[model samples]
Target chain A: MSSQPGTVRVPQEERTRAMRARLLEATVECLVERGFSGTSTTLVSERAGVSRGAQLHHFPTKNALVVAAVEHLTEVRGAELEKAAAALPTGRRRTRAVLQMLADHFTSPVFTAALELWVAARTDETLLAAVAPLEQRVGRQTHRLTVELLGADESRPGVRELVQATLDLVRGLGLANTITDDARRRRRILDQWAVALDDALADDDLQGETA
Target chain B: MSSQPGTVRVPQEERTRAMRARLLEATVECLVERGFSGTSTTLVSERAGVSRGAQLHHFPTKNALVVAAVEHLTEVRGAELEKAAAALPTGRRRTRAVLQMLADHFTSPVFTAALELWVAARTDETLLAAVAPLEQRVGRQTHRLTVELLGADESRPGVRELVQATLDLVRGLGLANTITDDARRRRRILDQWAVALDDALADDDLQGETA
Candidate 1:
């Protein structure tokens, strides 16, 4: 490849970026498969096919690696959610569609990996410091996105709470799924929620007009 | 005290039962304070102030100790929830009162201890086998209690889901509280949900009468 005239040499910075990405990705995988306690720098480097020295150069310790992975996990999850949001259908089915998207996000591997960290962070002060802020940011982002997607009118009574309830419901369902396959029960709950949400939002619109 | 004529000698069975309770309580404490990875049989024995021989005699392994602790934790939590339910006010504010009770249960120390076990169980087959069945039983019991407390008619369409959504919402709030003091946010969400629930249940009653 270096001999080819058209092949431009990859910059050192780009190489470093690519290596870091691999390491972070591997770290998430390890966290998911092996958990926080079981995951190690050596295992991540081996999984990423990167040398131990290079892995160390990027992330000095396991905590450092996990901290970076937290950001990466949130970014990947946020991007995926955004992409799904863009593709949602309009009209009567939008509420259910939006909810389905949120549920999918919560049940994905990234969320599972995040769950591992959240549990581990509860006891580890260093990890807690990093995870708590990112969790809040991600949470606020999800809440804002849900509000926009549902076209909820926050000025109306109970609208903001309804939006929050939707997020909390799905997150709880996600937690349920972590233990067992909760798909059938989850589907029933979501279906019922969609109807209730539509009625609540429509009622709010009516109130807005009357007031 | 043993020398007193009114004081009867404790039976062997009673002594064993008391010893088991101490160990189980200590196990929950260790799980909450130290998490799953940090919890060990030796630490639990020390915390319980029980001899190593007695701890080993009761629980041969850490897994055995945790498995027993799962049942003990559920029983303790269930007993507390039932007691709280019995004291709830029955009136216009009953719905809110019930939700507050549920929230309190989810945010309690027992729930936090269960959370540690749940996260650990995700990567452990033996713990999963024990925790999963117990979790289902507890879930069903909670759901049944919620239905009874709210006087919800399951025959009404979406009532069952509403009951479940209520549970999931509170559980999610509890999860949020694990990281930060989410009491203010939780109060608002619960307040909003109480209103929404009253409306839904009332609407169901209206439909039932008109039909």
Candidate 2:
């Protein structure tokens, strides 16, 4: 295919998809670097190497862009988690690995970006309206995935709460990391929590069998 | 309490002290309501019912004002915790109460203000310079207060980790509450953690004796 004309004749569908992906990724990068208020549509477009008009065409508003980026990142993480879960073997080790995976998710740029948006949404009504529902939906999906990943019998009395606690604990750990190097502290706590979790899970299964 | 023709003749030290308290209170209020970017020297002075000159005289800069507010709030919390701790009995019930107190501190306007400063400091160099050491100092003081509040045996193998986990867990819970009405979810996790803590504390003593 020789460049016979000014147009490269790329398919519009492919072009649009590529541009959208770039813009969303740029949004994530900006958010991870500059935070919510620091991120702007122009900045996102520039970072994406896309034209301003193209950025506007893809995302009409800042809220739309940031929200879409969050959704996109969540989807990507879901897929990664699915892949990770599929590759792992069953039992106690798997549970530990899954918890580590969950910890990684909490510590990732995905969480960092979400944190900025969450903080911004606290005061920005428009952003709150845009983010709250999307976040709720993503949060529910994450909880379900986490439950599946843990492979815990949620019907058990304490199992569900333990799983939820694990998520919340990791989330708190991640939040601590944002302010400073909480890695050492987080690891120490995680080690203790892991031991407690193993005991809890064992008790849950034993109770399940007896009941 | 004179409305005399001349100066009302309040002592300079007392007047300055009162004005400083007013400004800091206003700063926390604004941070809770409007967040960091929205809270300014002007807004703080106005809400504090103090004049601009008085505000500037007390806090030389916005960073100074905000950092002082954070330090002041932490001291206020420290005093509150000391009062509560002094009134409580030395036992498991006190442990639970301490956890609740920690939770309350995480959910207060002080935490909200700190959250704003933390997020802002992520990208703002001047703010980070002012905030990092102050935050470090507060974090150390908080950890000490927490250890005292829990009455944990720090020399024991796992007891210190458990206490640290408790702080991180509560901090995570507070962060969750910032995003949504996480009170219910937080209570559920807290109940589970409390049971675990009781067991852990008991185990630590047993292990301590065995070792």
Candidate 3:
């Protein structure tokens, strides 16, 4: 609700949340069809069937709208990871589940647009501030998953590095092949993950080697 | 040179090559500034100070100009790799050199533009064909370097996996980082590579029980 006493009769939390969700969804659609630079609040509002005034009420500026869209997509990504982690038995199953979840997310507009926006964010300071934490969060989940799946030897030479590397590989593949050959792209991703996981778990005392 | 003996004088082969090279450099400049959808053949010709007819003589279509640019970049990348490779002693030294060469190539506008073009290629079939083989060449080089550096143990357990994962990581970083913090990025990359390389060389054949 607005802090102003009588700004609106029903600036209720539910209404605001619903409007934000609609705008965010519309942003994803516009981003997918027209890219980050091409997407605009006008198009997003039109697609969401919200008046331009209504859209502005929720997001005062285009940058704000873009940031919110990125944040929303990041949350979707986090939720997907959580769902996958929840379904797994424990340990390596959880790791594999996360990988599968990543592959699935790449197929969705949320992941694709979020990534393109992340790339754009590198040039846009405001957007970068919003996306950096998302990356850190994903990195933390990956590192945690690696530790659980690989057990005590997770500290071994190649384990952590392997985690970072494999994560990047899937993300790169998703960016490189998002527009075509979905099945082939997914298989390539799974293959890369399966190999990286097996390698990390098998090595011991490797962490000290590089030092 | 034109084939007909009695025809009007055609441009010399060397002149044509020089003109083509100039246009390609300009195209790369345009690509770096405008991206795939924004770059234009006329802009490239103007940048090169060549007439449109001269530009068309070398590259008849917009796609052809891009394909030529990609080809020229690939050649430059290959030469850089060879030069870097030549500086190393043997074995792992050479592989490390290869890695440095890769880092260097990525910093070049030509290679960076090619990467941007690779993403664009996902939606453009002709561009995809032009870019696919370039990736294969890089992959093949990686495979060779891994074989030479790690020897017969590549298929054993996790070796191939670790190498692939590292490749993925570097590629992703190359695409995502904008401010070009090469020193820090390079250190992170080397740290991971060293870990993977050491583990691959380690003689342990069985899964360790614990840390």
Clashes of each: 0, 0, 3
lDDT (Cα) of model 3? 0.65
Q: Which tens-of-lDDT digit does each residue in B93-167 have in candidate 1?
A: 899999999999899888888888888888888889888888888899999999999999887777888899899
Model 1: CAPRI class: medium
Error of 1 at B45 (Å): 0.4
lDDT of each residue in A1-211, candidate 3, tens digit only: 4587565655576677788899998898777776776788999999888889889988988878877786787677667666666566665555556666665665567767776665566546776777677666755765576455435354455556556655655665565555445455355445545544566456554544554
The CA lDDT of each predicted structure is: 0.85, 0.80, 0.65
TM-score of chain A of 3: 0.78
lDDT of 3 by residue, B98-130 (tens): 555555555567656775576566546777776
- Model number with the top DockQ: 1
Q: Residues A1-211, candidate 2: write the lDDT tens digits.
A: 4754435555756788888999999999999999888899999999999999988987999999999998898899889988887887686567657767878888999999998888898989999998899888887887898888767777767677777778777887888788687777776677667666666666634322356
Give the range of the ten consecutive residues with the poorest summed lDDT in model 2 chain A.
A202-211
In the range A103-152, model 1's lDDT, one tens digit per residue, is: 88888878888888888889899989988988988888998889888888
Per-prediction DockQ comes to 0.54, 0.44, 0.31
How well is each residue in B135-203 modelled by candidate 2, as lDDT tens digits?
888877878988877767788776777777787788777887887988777766676676667666767
* TM-score of every candidate's chain A: 0.89, 0.88, 0.78
TM-score of chain B of each: 0.90, 0.87, 0.77
What's the ranking of the predictions by TM-score, best on top?
Answer: 1, 2, 3
Model 2: what is its DockQ?
0.44
- Using lDDT as the yardstick, the better of models 2 and 3 is 2
By lDDT, the candidates rank as 1, 2, 3
